[model samples]
Target: MLGVKKIGWSVLLSLFVLVACSANEKEQSVSQNDGGLQVTFTTPKKVEAGKKTEYTVHVSRNGNPVADAEVIVHLEMADMDHGLNGFRGKMTESGVYKGQAVLPMGGDWIAYVKVKRGSEKVTKRFEFKAEGGMMSPEELEKSGLHENGSLKNPDF
Candidate 1:
């Protein structure tokens, strides 16, 4: 009976660790709905730091694609104050907008996608991780790419 109980506890511990690790893994895509608008944001399974990566956002309303909306993606470090990085998304097709961002470092980051059509506007936030090498705050500042507060270059 003692041996059986030990084995059971070991299995439970292993399962708990597995679940915790999986929960921390970054999601490649996330979807959310506000009012009647639905937005789906997608990124690469693994985003590398200091590399330009493509981001995609799909906007729809009432199950129909929204092709006439302006879309923009803003990125910021989740744990630290990295200012605000903005990327203007260009519509590639109906309901699909694509943009690129170069993450400053490898860590937790949030992407906020803003969609606007006429007077209707909605914003969605997605959290993900960037892998690869890390950079110091000083280096990021010297890179001449980091902004202070608001978006310095929307075209970037």
Candidate 2:
């Protein structure tokens, strides 16, 4: 009788573990879909207007590179005319994506990234300061953009 009781308990334990594992797998898949594509910006976290900055975006899934994904970046500045926007280029031979932008004003600018993977979508936003001021190339390197600040371009 003891032997039968042990076997029954063992079988019940195994069944519980199997059910828990199945549920965990489903939950993980759902979370991954919610996270969408991850995004990162390579340029200086803060910048001055009119200074060219380089940006890069990386797309991946399950810790492996996800090729052919689309990444959209937008820069919204209160002082600038219209905002800046661009799409991440296709993966180069090196296997990463890149984009570029020049901020046009000195106020706070918001960098927004929207990543789309098949039916899933992910969005992220980052804020940075674009200084406004006028100076020689040397001064510009040390300080920020001209004093006029952003143009507040309505087209944005």
How many clashing pairs per prediction, in order?
0, 8
Tell me the lDDT of candidate 1.
Answer: 0.73
Local accuracy of candidate 1 as per-residue lDDT tens digits, 1-156: 125774465346445544553576664799999767899999886676667789999999888999989998888877666666758888999999998777765566788898999998888999876664444456555544553323345564
* Model 1 regions more than 4 Å off: 1-27, 136-144, 147-152
Worst 10 residues of 2 by lDDT: 25-34
Ten-residue stretch with the least lDDT total in model 1: 143-152
| Candidate achieving the largest lDDT | 1
Q: Pick the candidate with the highest TM-score.
A: 1
Model 2 clashing residue pairs (backbone): 79-150, 79-152, 80-152, 80-153, 81-153, 82-156, 133-145, 133-146
Error of 1 at 81 (Å): 1.3
Q: How high is the CA lDDT of each candidate model?
A: 0.73, 0.51
List ranges where model 2 is wrong by over 4 Å: 1-34, 78-81, 84-90, 93-95, 134-156
